[model samples]
Target chain A: MQAIMTLKQVNYQAENKHILHDINWAIPVGAQVTLTGPSGSGKSTLLRIMAAMISKTSGELVFDGQPIESYDPVLYRRQVSYCFQQPTLFGETVADNVTFPYRIRKQPVDHDHILAALEYVGLGEQTLTQPIVDLSGGERQRVALIRNILFLPRILLLDEVTAGLDEQNREIIHRWLRHLNVDRGVTTIMITHDAQEIAAASTLAKVVAGRLEVQA
Target chain B: MNLAVNNTSLFFAAMLVLVALGISLWQKLGLDKDIIVGVVRAIVQLFTVGYLLKYIFRVDNVWLTLAMMGFIIFNAAWNAKKRGAGIANAFPIALLAIFISTGVTLGVLILSGAIRLIPSQIIPISGMIASNSMVAIGLAFRSLNSQFHDQRQGVLERLALGSDLLDASIAIVREAIRTGMAPTIDSAKTVGLVSLPGMMSGLIFAGVDPVHAIKYQIMVTFMLLSATSLGSIIACYLAYRSFYNAQKQLK
Candidate 1:
């Protein structure tokens, strides 16, 4: 099996504070990897580095055997979708937010596919026309997830996506994620502090103070 | 009509002073003393220019008019810089835009015989063109800065997707251009119905025929629109380059 993403001895410092230091990690293709850590354990920083939101100070990152720098950052990001911890919806309508990536890419947007993705996330058809500001937290998370899926990225980076959701919504998300990984072979790297989610993951890695230690 | 000091002027001046004092006393409201000082300074400056203009009209020396126009441009540039303080090298760019826009507009107007090359025509027309350009440039800078800030993350996202920096910023640049031109557009739309413009009113007061004053007014309006559009477009394009580094990444 080939590794989908590799971080070799990565070191990152932001605002004079060491965020990720001497980090070596690998995610094999089609793996369901969950990163579990305490608050301020550099999980978000590592994810951001993978997404190319911030640059790493030292070492190399390679995605699918190509040096990350060799590929355009925007193209890389498009191929790897990062669902933020706090969902950031751009447009006023759900349909607008979902189709944003397609619009940016200048591709033909399919409203039918968008509606299907929304339905997959348990959102009603009418939700597409509803204003984003009127949506609840759970609805917004679903919208973000649908957006990521619609973009059809090779890798999905989840950052505490269900942190603020109720148990019902949490179960719905977990089930959808499990189905995505097990059935579709979609590569998923999720960060979570939830014990239930940690127990359910195929592989669990703990991060402490910028260092990763795979749990026994 | 009698040339006596009108009660309206005294009342307006008194009201302005009262507002300044009130704002000064209410420091907790975030109104700074510099704002009050600026208002007072403007009052003094405009009054001084008014008295000097009377002597200038009497003497009718072209050099004196040109010299005073230079002073007005310098002051306009300074005010523009103050308004757009955060932009790097904004003062020089703003001054350059103002100079180019005003010079082109005035030159075209004079050459076409729309405005006679005299103090009465040149002074007011040049001042109007220069000040309007200054406002347009200031708005362009402000809109550019705010648009960049608001869309920085989205722009970075686009860059990571193999899009060029120019491609990523195109939407924001378009928005800024639209916002920067809004005032000029509004003025053009409402020129006659909403307000009587200063140049036409001044001409009427100087005993010119109404038809003649209307022609000059129409010419001035079109000139202002052209000057503002050119200044804003040039300034926005120039300022946008400063936001990115050589590595094609946002700074």
Candidate 2:
């Protein structure tokens, strides 16, 4: 099995306080990994570091056998997409959020692709032109999910993506993630505090006091 | 030829008595002592500037003129930098913004022979250009800081979706520059109807021909618009980076 991302002795600190100390993890290609931990256990920080949103104080972060530092940060983020725990939507309309992938790549926004992605997320085709301000939390989360995956990134780092979703929406997102991994072979690193999500994950990594304990 | 400023004491005393009315009103309105302090500082500063200008004009060297222009820009940039204390390296950003605007505008005037690069023309004109640029940069900085703060999630989300730093901040940068330049644009629109600007009023009070003063004032407005637009754009571009880290995440 080939590893897609390898972290060795990762450490992060701010203002004389340690956030992550000596973290070592390997994310294999096409694997779905879930990170579970209590609040303030540095799970989100670890996820952000994985996404290259923030750099580690000291460590080697390698992606696809190349040091993450070797890749252009913008292109790296394009391949390794990071979704926040909160439903972070940009611009006024769902089209605005969904078309973001095309806008970044300097490619024309395909209306059909946007509509299809929205529909896949249980949103109607009419929802594409709808203003994000009018969206409920669950709808916003689904919109964000579709937005991140529209370009089909190699790795997806999701932080509490289903926290605010209803049971139906949660199941919708779960099926999407499963499809993304099984069908599309996209690598995933997710942070979830829910017991059911932890129990259901094929590979579980728990962080406690900035230490990782993997149980598969 | 220097214009005579006669009866300086009487003029100042009358001004003081007039401002006392304002102080009384401010006190009634529960305004703080900062107002009084500001007024006192203004008096001291103007008098000091008056003496310095007298000497500088008497010396009448190009180097002195350049020094005065530098001093004006530095002071203006310092004040502008304070408006966005949260931005890292704000003073340098403001200095660069003010320099670009003031330098390019004055360079055009000098190159076109619209104005002489001398103490009389360069000092006063560059002062206006620099100060206006200062205000524009301050507005740009504040707008950028607040926008990045309020729209943290939006900016970061865009980055995650593969938007480059420039692409992610395009809308915000546009808004910030517009916000910075709006006051100048609006003021120019309402010039004669709303209020007489300070430089025009000063020229008229000094007994210059009204038509001549009006021409100078028109020139001032055009120069200001040019400087402020450039300054705000530059400031926004430079300051936007402070909100993001090395990996393009919202800091």
Candidate 3:
């Protein structure tokens, strides 16, 4: 399989400390790779670097056939989306959060599609106009997830998005991820600590002491 | 009739401070030390400025006038920079904002013949314009800093969705500008009714016609509004970029 992203000797440093040393990894096209590591092992930092949310201290990162820097940051981010561990909902209502992707793209918001996505995530049509301030943690996370997929990206970076979800919601998210990866062919690179999720992943990668180790 | 303001009369004006000090002591306000220090500083500073202005006016040199204006603007910018302590390049940004606003307003005044290009005229007007711009820019910086910090998550989320820097920060920028311009706008609205401003009263005390003093005051008000608006907008546009990194990510 051709690789969608290749990071060669990427390193991240902050405040005179090497957070990620000379490290390298490649993400395959249409692959769901579970990334596991002990706490503070630079998992999220690596994910952010892949998402272009942060600049690498040194080394080369290429996306598709071109250098990441060659692409406009806005357009690059649109094609490669990132989800935060703590979901952030902006503006006033759930509809605001759900339709942001369309807003930024200057496309007409499809309320029907938004309602459908909310329903798929176990949130009803009534949740569309609900105030974001009134949402629970699970609801906010689901909204953020649905927002990320409103317009599909070639790759999705998940930074422990399901860390605090209940079993049912977690299962829903897992099923959603599988559908996205299998049916839609969106490449997924997720940081996770769930044992079952780790056991079930088709491809597993670990970041130990800032180094990548692929498991067969 | 011109009211006498010789040294004797001015010396007697010290009665006002004594009255204030007596009241503070009577009320047990414990403000005696502060009042004494403030009175002494005010006297010294005003006398020094008075003598400097007298000398600059006598010479009537364009360079001397310009140097005086620059001094006022530099001091104003320095004070404003303190309000934006953590913002990158805050001093230069403040200086530029104050300079442009003051320069533009003074240029218009001189060109319109409302004020002459001399120390007596240009220096005082420049002081007023620079000081107002400085306050406006300071308020703008404070607003920008707080808004960016408080709205970090919102800005980051917008960036994640591929919104460009300007698009991500438009709302915050507008809010900061509005915050900076609010005082000027409020004073314009309540100009004559709320209080008699300094320039008009000073002209009146100098035996200028009331109608003429009112005209000068109106001109001052218009110039102030223009100065503050320009300063706030320039400062905000320059400062918003400080919140982001080279990767276009929120710092």
Candidate 4:
């Protein structure tokens, strides 16, 4: 499979503090990679740079053979999605959160597709009509996950998506992520520290002291 | 004929009421120093302006008239810049808002012969416009800051989901402007009922024709509303732009 995303010599520095140094990686299409690291190690920062939520201090970042800066940021984000650690749902209803991709794109709301996406994440169609404020943490995370995939990004960047989830919900999320890779060929790059989570990945990478160490 | 000397004495008598207010504040709220200093500062500032305006009106040099107008606008903007302390180009933003609102309204009035460009006509009207615009812009900054703080998560989410800054903040910009202009709109709605307006009362006190005073008061109201609306919109736009950094991050 061709590389769907590539970062070369990426150095992220803030206030002379080196967060990530001389990082180089290429994520292949349909590959599931888990990035493991200690707390405050630059794992999430790398993911953010991949998601274009932040710019690298110095380096070349290419998405699908084009420079990241060449694409419209909004359009780039649509193609490569990022789900924050703590899911932030906007507006009142779950439907609002589910329908945001359409709203932002100025496209007609695909109600059937939204429901299907939620169902794939183990949420029933009825969840769409409910208020998001009342959802449990796991449910909110699931909703956030469904929201990110509704538009079908080429690559998914998840930041410790299951850190606080119970085993039941964690299994559900893991299953859906695998399904995305297997069925839709969605490239997944997740920042996680869970042993079982890291073990399931086809490729593993560890970040320590501002350097990326890829392990198979 | 117009009780000019008597009114001057009455103005001093008004100071006694202010003193009473200060004393009551001291006795009841322990705000003695604040009230005394505020009242004294107001007296000194107003008297100084009154003397300065008297001299400017008599001088009749066009450049000096324009220069005084600039000074008044600069003072108004300087006060408003503090309201948006974090906003980049805060002072320039305030200056632009004051200039546009006051300039556009005065331009129309001069064109229509409703007012001349003389110091006497320009100074008082410009003061009214600049002061009201300053307050409106300040409120715009305050509202912009608070709304962004409250909607931070939502904003970032939108940004991540492929929405540009303008798209994300359109609703917020409108909200800030509306909130900024709300006081002026509400005041306009309740004028003459809840209170006699300042210009009208002052004109009537000066023995101008009641009808003429009412006309001037109406003009002032229109000018104030227009100034506030325009000022708030400008300030809100500038304040909103300040939220994003060079990397388009909401810092």
Candidates in descending TM-score order:
2, 4, 3, 1
**Candidate 4 — which residues are off by over 4 angstroms?**
A124-126, B1-41, B59-64, B107-119, B208-218
Docking class of 1: incorrect
Give residue B216's lDDT in candidate 1 (0 to 100): 79
In model 2, how large is the Cα lDDT of residue B58?
85
User: In model 4 chain A, where is the ten-residue run with the lowest total lDDT?
Assistant: A114-123
Estimate the Cα RMSD of every predicted model relative to the unseen true structure.
Answer: 5.2, 2.9, 3.4, 3.3
Query: What is the fnat value (0 to 1) for candidate 2?
Result: 0.82
- Candidate 3 wrongly placed segments (more than 4 Å): A106-116, A122-126, B1-41, B107-119, B208-212
Record all residue pairs in model 2 with backbone atoms less than 3 Å apart, i.e. clashing: none
In candidate 3, position B243 carries an lDDT of 87
Model 1, C-alpha of A38: deviation from truth (Å): 1.7
CA lDDT, every prediction? 0.80, 0.87, 0.90, 0.87
Candidate 2 residue lDDT tens string, B89-208: 899999999998999999998898879866878898899999999999999889988888888777877877778899989889999999999999999999988888887888888888
Q: Candidate 3, after superposition: displacement of residue A89 in Å?
A: 1.7
For residues B73-171, what per-residue lDDT tens digits would candidate 1 score against the true structure?
Answer: 777777777766567778877778778888888999999988788897788888899899888887888887887887777666555444566676777
- TM-score for each candidate, following the candidate numbering: 0.76, 0.90, 0.87, 0.87
Q: By lDDT, is 2 or 3 better? A: 3
* Best by the TM-score measure: 2
Better of 1 and 3 by lDDT: 3
- Cα error, residue B55 of model 1, in Å, equals 14
